[model samples]
Target: MGRRKSHGSSKSKQHVTHQRQLSLAKRNEINALCEKLFVCEYAFHTALSINSAYVTQLWDNYVEISTILEKVKRLEEMKTESPKRSQGIGQFINWLKENGANLDGASVAEFPGYDLGLKAERNFQENELILRIPRGLIFSTHNAAPELIAILNDPLIQHMPQVALAIALLIERHKENSKWKPYLDILPTTYMTVLYMTAADMIELKGSPTLEAALKQCRNIARQYSYFNKVFQNNNNAVSAILRDVFTYERYW
Candidate 1:
């Protein structure tokens, strides 16, 4: 009886070891696949990025490609059917689309099984344009807040016509707050999250009494003025007009 019990324990240990080995092997294969995908994506997007100062300025797309690679690695061990994984992949897809547009000035080709961009589109892709994400905000680390992310990652605001407007809104929002300026610097390395948060910081600066107070004032003012809401909505013309008005207002001040 003791011999039988020992035999059973040994078998169990062997099974566990086999499972671990399988998992490790799978992970290594995933890493290799991700490397191949990254190179392909970078090559495809870089070709389209010509002539744009923003995209050309970066030279190499290692940062963006690495982010996608990291995300794929996380997905390798995850259950493909899990809702959380699906949502995460969805968000990552959006991040890619936006970054592609911001840098390449062209919409990224769709993912095989995911269609977040198609769902986000209001029309049949006529007026719809590429939605580029600010490189600084793309992270394989953690999820960012929705509002703060909207400053850089909002699907509704990243497209062609709206891209410039989004940048203006972000800039205005950042310039208003001195405390957040360090995060909002208009430098090449600024992450999109920092830009958006800093922009919010700037707008909040107007009502210096408190963070809450500043938020309230900005919301109230934006709500009161249709133009403000339009600008916030991030229409191309609205953003252009807002940019003009901002300069005009600055000149007077």
Candidate 2:
């Protein structure tokens, strides 16, 4: 009999192609919506400035556009589904095992408030080892790209170790096939940090002693981001490309 074609591979290729097309279409739609939303926002602001009669209409349109933008964004994200918890965690566990990690009695579990919790599956005696992670497995500026490391070492940058590490992480996160993809995939998309909270959300913290501290912290971070943005803007290098997106307040928080 004649050789049979591999329909599985063909179908896989078709599926990938279809997904790409869908993603491109969604991106185009989002772009169009964003342009319209921008115009609406500008009109609303203009109306407010002159105290125009159409202020309410413009404001309503702006709100509607914002809602649609959010829905489109969510749809795009759903289409580009992140790796499942089991898949990402399983991959990390396999990697650890391959690297001679001693994760015998320890297992990952989901808690009520806490997202992921490390639990001891079995009873451990005194002085018994539960889990041991090798230093080599950790991601740091040391293991980052040579160009990135050079940037971090530059006197002009003058960033602390944590800042350098943060920049390195942002660069890696932007890469399509990053080695840390599995690990990064598990990170929370949105944090409950004060930096991310809306004004309405902040009202819940009224009468709290930490409210002032949180506001101060937010202002400090904004200043730092502005400083970093100007510093990197002057340097026209690959480092700037990475650091450009890294100095955002949201990223810092």
Per-residue lDDT over 160-183 for candidate 2, one digit per residue giving the tens place of the 0 to 100 score: 666566666666655435555545
Residue 67 deviation, candidate 1, in Å? 6.1
lDDT of 1 by residue, 123-149 (tens): 336765545455555421122222333
Q: lDDT score, residue 96, model 1?
A: 49
The best candidate in terms of lDDT: 2
Best by TM-score: 2
**What does the lDDT come to for candidate 1?**
0.32
lDDT of each: 0.32, 0.51
Off by over 4 Å in 1: 1-25, 41-67, 75-253
Clashes of each: 12, 0
Worst 10 residues of 1 by lDDT: 1-10
Positional deviation of 101 in candidate 1, in angstroms? Answer: 54
Error of 2 at 204 (Å): 4.0
